[model samples]
Target: MKVEDFDMFCTLLRQRSGLVLTSDKAYLLESRLMPVARKWTLKSLDELAVAVRSKRDEALLRDITEAMTTNESSFFRDQKPFDQFKQVVLPHLLANRAAKKQIRVWSAACSSGQEAYSLAMLLQEEGARLAGWRIEILGTDLSSEMVNKARAGLYTQFEVQRGLPITHLVKYFKQMGDKWQLNDDIRGKVQYREYNLLSDLTPLGQFDVIFCRNVLIYFDQPTKSKVLEAMAKLLPPDGILYLGGAETVLGITEKFKPMEGQRGLYTLAAK
Candidate 1:
């Protein structure tokens, strides 16, 4: 691909999905987009790029963005965050908000539903303690395809093996031919939607906890700051924010402060 063409595609991705790609990522683009080209019956990625640059077909641009957004995810990925939520954060929220008996959590950029379902399983284990509480688990992703898959709540054997505990698996998932389907009750606990973190979050409402792990690293610094700021506005003063281990709010935003013992947990700073 030509340098100018690569730059144009990168810019288009940023405009559409808030993903920041550079010229060094040419190989990545080719590997991902080649399949898209084949799927659309185009001769080559160059042809797909030409279609994107024509600016005449809005649907083509949408297809390119969807092709580029990474959809990698697993159940209980990087276990520490969920453990902290169960041991520390959930207890604190239960105590502090006892009067309301409500807990709201948003799994921002949740891909394929594992993270949200993992949360549901953890809450389900709490049993009688959560009987009267209203738990809202909202999972959103920029890709509409991902949201649809999450809503379906079915996973292949290999997908189930990644970070999903055996005990919980047996208890919560039923065998559906060669695949596993999450129990309808646990699946129903979460509400999945298509959301773009780079755009308005107002329509999704607010939350007591937001899990936006491993997603901001794909964005530029300005986009990262914008996302964090938006998250801060959507959280309560004492709401918890969970980030990927490599991500942080230290240099980006001061609206959240890291919790002492929790590796990636941050509490929204009081105004």
Candidate 2:
């Protein structure tokens, strides 16, 4: 693809999905967009670029944006966060919300439901502790395809093997042909929806904890600040925010302060 065409494509992606792409990322774009190009019977990446440049076809632009967004994820990815959730966050939330008898969690950019499902399993293990509590675990992603997969609650053997404990897998999933179908009991705990971090989140409501890991790295600084600010508004003053190890609240916003004991955890500071 020509440099000008590539720049236009990158700009379009940044505007639509908040994904930042450099000239070095041309190969990445080609790898992801090639399939879309073929599906549309386009001869080459350059041709696809022209189609995107037309801007008259919003559907085509959406297709391109969706094609570029990464949807890779697995069950209970990076076990530490979930462990902390069970050991610290859940207990605190349970105690604090005892009177209300309800708890809310938002898994922003939840690719295929694993993070939300992991939380469900943790809550299930708590058993009677959450008996009367209204547990709302909401998982949202920019990609509609990913939200659909999360709703399906199906996983391949390889997918189940990654980051999931063998014991939980045996207990919560049943064999469906060669794949594992997450038990409806666990599956029902999470509600998946299509959401874009770049857009307004008023319809999704608030949360006690929000897990938005490893996603903001793809976004530019302005987009990251915007997203973090929006998330801060949705979170309670004491609500927890969990970010990827590479991500931090520092330099992004001052609304959140890193927790003293937790590494990747942050809490909205008191006024």
Q: Write the per-residue lDDT of candidate 1 for residues 37-138, one digit (tens) a residue.
A: 887789987788787767547777777888899998999999988889889988999998899999999999998999999999999998788889999999
The deviation in Å at residue 12 for candidate 2 is 0.9
State, as a TM-score between 0 and 1, how close model 1 is to the true structure.
Answer: 0.97
Q: lDDT tens digits, residues 1-271, model 2?
A: 7888888889889999999998889999889888888988898988888877674487778788889998878878888999899899988998899899989999999988888999999889998878888998999998888899999999999999998889999999999999999999999999999899899987788899999999989998889989988898998888999999999878988888899989999998777
Candidate 2 segments whose C-alpha is farther than 4 A from its true place: none
Report lDDT (CA) for all predictions.
0.90, 0.89
> Candidate 2 clashing pairs?
none
Backbone clashes under 3 angstroms, per model: 0, 0
Which ranges in model 1 have alpha carbons more than 4 Å from their true place?
none
Instruction: Report the Cα lDDT for residue 241, model 2.
Output: 94
